[model samples]
Target: MAEAVAAGRAASRGVPGRSASGRSRHARILAALVALSALVYAASSLLRLRAFQASTYDLVIFDQALRSYSRFGAPVAMVKGVHNGFGPDFSVLGDHFSPILAVLAPLYWLHDGPETLLVAQAVLFALAAVPVWRYAARRFGPVSAHLVAGAYALSWPIAEALAFDFHEVAFVPLLSALLVERYDAGRRVQAALAAAGLLMVKEDMGLLLVGFGFFLLARRGERRAGAAYAAAGIAATWASSRVLISLFGGDNDYYWAYGSLGDGMADAAVRVLTHPWILPGAVGSPPVKLLTMALLVVPLLLLPLRSPLALAALPLLAERMLADRFPNWWEPGYHYNAFIVAILVMAAVDGAYRLRGRRPPAALTRLRPVAALRRSRPVAALRRMRPWRALRRHLPAAALLAGAVVTVPFFAFGDLADPGLYRPDGRDRAAGAAVAAVPDGALVETANNLGPALSARTRVLLWDREPRGAPWVVADIGRHTFPFTTLEEQRHRVARLINEGYRPVFRQAGYIVLTRESAAPR
Candidate 1:
């Protein structure tokens, strides 16, 4: 492996003006991937929106929160409990304290719908390719950099996340990629801001930041900065659960997820720590953990394992592995992976590059694209470091393991082949019309899947919840709404609206809209 790297190194060095040519090639690859990734994700998400694939659970949370911000109201989820759990009229901040959503809130004033959230999510996720491409370019040559960028952008986990719905997690990849880029570039202020942006995406990200800070301190020699990062992350995590979310969301504070361990966050922590011997058991036995590792790392070729930067992902991995939440915590192609995917990819690039004990040469910094990296201490130091023969010895194993992934079936691909997932039809149009008939800020009850369409309103009750105070209700009587019971049950429930003085405002296409008799007309 060293001989191969040495030969490749010599070829690039022997040619006149080769370095400049290589930097130009890297620039083109980065530019192409960034553009292609953004376009595909944005177009696909928009198509999903036009179809009926987008759901209420997450899309509504993001849209309603943004609506509140745009309208200068408190961040209330109009569609809370429709597809997931939360109190009606609940502030989204109370749930996750993601103040960062406020940054894009103004867009709702110009356009109001779930599509806005979808577009924003797509853009954010695709923008992650920018940093990933740059990092890969620095790690590998301009030629191999293309392959890394392709994998980073087209990873099943990332595609699955984009196809699912709008999540604060969509922001995770962008922020994480930026974190690694700025940190490696030695742009302290930019890196710190990137880290801060990550915590604003979700409370759990604070713990991951603590791990990141530890890696920087232990591996990169940035003592003071690392200490500050660790302290900030620890404080933010404590505040997110204990102070911010607790004061806003109540004592539950999302600790219900760890019900098997204890009652709440405090109890769970105490239980885990006090029983030191239970650490092994916490990960659900050795074999299961090994399987989980393969699921995560195999797709990426296990490149993350070759670097100390892998430690940045440890806290998040531990968090997911120890959870008993619907087998979702262990899944590879889901929203949970959004938190660690970008970090792992960046780590993988570093790992692969470190195999030869080389870093981006200072000459590469002369290029406009990498001019941000003005410092070259990493390269200077690595030039003096000894060869990593251990990594060389394992190259064959890594190559063989990476080769197996090529044989996996397209069925193992991230997205489904269902036509309904990508096309709009009568039911979708009917649902939208029903939601549109209701006035803005009107109190309405709706099906689980349809809730996000009306999420811009200030009042909405989920299908499972009793429609006690709702002044208006919309139901797709002929169809089944997800995360709820049968269509027959929904039709029966809608039939009962007559006893509550609700008169039909509009009825067509298996959709029925109703309002209380004593209320205003449609």
Candidate 2:
């Protein structure tokens, strides 16, 4: 087994056709591309914040959580608590099992603001390119490596994650790539470490780890390790979601998105086993689910379908698709897809390599007729065709790269081309002034759009329905903000506050700053 594995590795190295210096040069070029990607991602996200396009539901929630972490306090996110009607003492962990956000606390130590989280997320997304390039280089050539790396970096999943806000998934792409690359390279220890980190990212990440274990089990001499990993993943997911989350004051019932399947996980599993069509029924009824599944593979020209490594994505995909409560999970948007981007791209590289080497799947090798047909005249003639040869080798990567480039104009990255992305208008200035009117350290209720802007300075609660009686209020009445469906609803709320002794102290560009008359002035 060792000899055969070594021979395969040698063949992969030889196929790349690069000398030591050439390989080093390619590495340097790939590094430059990764740096450029990071810059672009950071600039785009930060610019959105500057333009008042960032929302408080998430960006501010994460910001508040990270702030507590930076200060060595509990992972409290008042924005989330206030929005959800939980009190200011609420811990973010009670909502989702992502302790990995604490790793980013050091970034807050340097900048101490929401912008720090956005920049950190961009860097994390860009860092995945390194592992992706290394893995692709081992399978394909240097050129294909670069193409795959670029494609992964610019993929729509990462773009959507960036467009939405900072999320725990920012750590997923890099860790998933590392796990696949290191495991394939026979460095089980590093791969295990990556898997461990993945478990920290979210409670559901263990399902992805379990899928990877199934992938490993299919490979020679890996069954023992695979079994151990699969068992660990199962244990970790159960402990984290059921025990850890509950221990942290979270209600797991809130995440029961599979009500349509059954009462709970056990019931759903039993139903899925007994009525297999139930899974398909759920996925098919919403035609958008099919479109999303297609969009995931279509960009890579369906190469992922050919590799068993794609199994790593199945659990997560099923988790999202089977959930009927959250429509966003079934759609091809937000940070939901970011978890599988690395797995899909790595599988595509593996698929292309298998095609280039003319390696038939193990199952196909057992079929006598299939083996005989390989030596047939028609097969030989087809192999000799230039287009057929190209399709089996370099063309796959080139076509994938071309497709990625072609599709960039339709995704969030395309916003970089619009001049408006760079310009912050009067609304932004007014929001800033409104944020400024609320003195530092004062308790302020802010609109969902302006929460992040003041979260760094003021103690902010979401200015949603039912005033929290905060001493200072900053809301945008000129346009509708989150939690308020109409502009009149926002205006009426502000008017009610005024009649109750809260007076508008600052108003500009439809932004209003109100302070309670009875409260001591700052």
Query: RMSD for each model, in Å, please?
Result: 11.0, 6.4
Per-residue accuracy of model 1 over 84-121 as CA lDDT, tens digit each = 44555678877787888888888787788777877777
Q: lDDT score, residue 412, model 1? A: 23
- The numbered model that scores best in TM-score is 2
Off by over 4 Å in 2: 1-17, 357-393, 517-522
Model 1 spans with C-alpha error above 4 angstroms: 1-25, 81-89, 220-225, 249-252, 285-293, 356-426, 429-442, 456-460, 477-492, 503-511, 517-522
Pairs that collide in candidate 2 are none
Model 2: per-residue Cα lDDT over 123-227, one tens digit each: 889888877877887766777777888898889889989998789999999899989888877788999999999999999899998999888898888888888
Name the 10 consecutive residues with the lowest summed lDDT in model 1: 1-10
